[model samples]
Target: MDLKLSERYEDYREAVRVFLEEHRSVWRQPMADSDGRPSAAGRSWQALLIEHGYTCRTIPKQYGGHGGKADILESFIAAEEFHRVGAPTGLANQGISMFVPTLLECGTPEQKERWIRPTISGEIVWCQGYSEPGAGSDLANLQTRAVEDGEDFVVNGQKIWTSSAHFSDMMFVLVRTEPEAPKHHGISYLILSMDTPGIEVRPLKTMTGRAEFNEVFFTDVRLPKTQIVGERGAGWQVANTTLKHERGMLGDPGQANAMLGRVVAIMEEETLDGVRLIEHSGLQDRLLRLQARAQAMKLHGLRLLTHGLKGEDAGVARLIVKLNGTILNHEIAAFAIDVLGELGALYEDSPHLKDRGFWQTTHMFSLGLIIGGGTSQIQKNIISERGLGMPREPKPASKGA
Candidate 1:
């Protein structure tokens, strides 16, 4: 990988930096209410991103995006800018980073024309419906059934941990079309309108005191057969497309780098035993290691993007990045808690709080990253089997078999 920024990219980087600096005040506002859900301001911030055209950075111009190269370096730069200013980019990350890419890769021409443009324009919001009550880490074990009914599929089952489901207008879901087949096969992907009858969204509050996720239940919810993205019974393969999209967004360097800076800033401001937290050698050492890991991960992300631009298979590098991102997030949260001491235990809006109780919030939110998309153990399994070509672990015996 060249690692060198051309003059044009240099200009782009500077422009992003300037924009973030200009918007720092607007972005620094408190995000969640006492309940931990995104405030109305957060939604407004997302609309602001759309208005400013930043939300469509990686989207194709034909699809109403800027259509600049979707390289990791540019994305990193943009993410850093947003993070530095505490921007509301995460609100749109799922829509822009995951769903948009999935649409581009697997959606039919009409699907793209219908959904991509509106999504990029912020006219519609989407949530993922992959994790079921019984099938989170073991995604193939999902039992959500979608029976073919004329020109539509009648979906029935419950999905849990669906982020933004309460606020989203649409959902991308994986459903079992053939239950007798092997667990991984006979699955199909579908897009469903959230307002459809028999669809229920029950938001769940997390340790962070927010309803960022929901338990979505569907009972004979009818969706157009045209909603299927790939061949029926081949949803497993198509689901990989969405997973890859998700991994890329989660492993973005800019987000990690920005987060690291925030963590460091908080540490610097905090003191313990009459000494600044950042001055502690142990903390400094850990922070340094985290910084190095984050930088390496960023470069790895850029390398993957570069290979992608060259039409090369990036393979399991994404898994490595995801693992690293989750680790870094946890480490940063831990460090923040250590620095804040007892104060960290206080939730948002508490008296004498630092950064509106971000430490506590970060600690709570970091665990979600480990469980969302894929678990840390699942990522390890993928890396061992797919990346390192190791033998798969022996399966456990069935309880009653």
Candidate 2:
């Protein structure tokens, strides 16, 4: 979608471009620790973004964000430009994309004051603690426990598939605060310091041969009750706020543009049977379709952003964004793999190959995009029950019946 950039966004766009140009030297593929934020080098990259006015634009003035009347579309545009130049803006880190928005909506004055600045500045890193060994897609069924003790909530539970937990200084964890309360009811959202005694972060290797995820175990890790974001036992609701942001970020069209650009780059230069890959009518049609979808998703995102600027709900498009975006991502990367044939499949062994075999890395990482933020299956269910207002499937009757 061609953006109608008025004077309002023109300066901002130029500023972002300049930032990318100046900092190009520090650029590499932003390393993700787990939840897809910059890890190690990513921290330095993000700290610089915050230093410039490129990030934290929506944060209110009082809470130490760039505070102003910036529209959400600005962030999207910046993302596009960043990806185009291969810069790591860190604007889309789960911390910025998911958690900050949640805080803006529900955080208390003190809570926002205490956490927002440091988080935005990259002084503290965060890992999500929602998915458990048992709770992967069925998140509310989480079994981690947090018992109340005076002013503290003593936590004991295990969270698996936690990204960057080993490298983070803090975690936003969901724990069952009221054991007797219904499964969904007793959960609470709390910020826990990773340094707290009895908290263990152990790396869990992925099929990709990298360990950006971890299984975090907590035994009696105590957090002040004041650390809770919403009211006690309201964690389920609080978590939904984060998820909504997450799904939106995941399904964003700007991301599709990045992937599509990579595919086009490969298609133009690659060959099959001595014929340029892009010269193939069939491959050309596929690229056109992916481009169209990227445009559609991009335009849809702008529509949502327009509504947001008008203080309207981002509208029905919100529901399908994650599902559609993630699937297209997988397809685009898969197409590149098919075109490159063996070279795309090479990893560290073929350091001389294109993207240092990062195409293969991206192919594997694509599945995480599908699985994280909510699996594609769960997303379909949301589109059905929530978007189309379809009746939910009936649950099985208990034996007592």
- Compare the candidates by TM-score and give the number of the best one: 2
Evaluate model 1: give its lDDT. 0.76
Per candidate, the number of residue pairs that clash is: 3, 0
| Model 2 ranges with Cα > 4 A deviation | 1-3, 22-53, 91-95, 103-105, 243-254, 281-285, 306-314
Structural similarity to truth (TM-score) of each candidate: 0.81, 0.85
- Over 246-329, each residue of candidate 2 has an lDDT whose tens digit, in order, gives 433423457777777877888888878888888989878888888898889887877776666566765457778778888888
What does candidate 1's lDDT look like per residue over 271-298, in tens digits? 7777888899998898898888778877
lDDT of each: 0.76, 0.77
Residue 186 shift from truth in candidate 1, angstroms: 1.1
Residue pair clashes in candidate 2 = none
**Once model 1 is optimally superposed onto the true structure by TM-score, how far is the C-alpha of residue 64 displaced, in angstroms?**
2.4
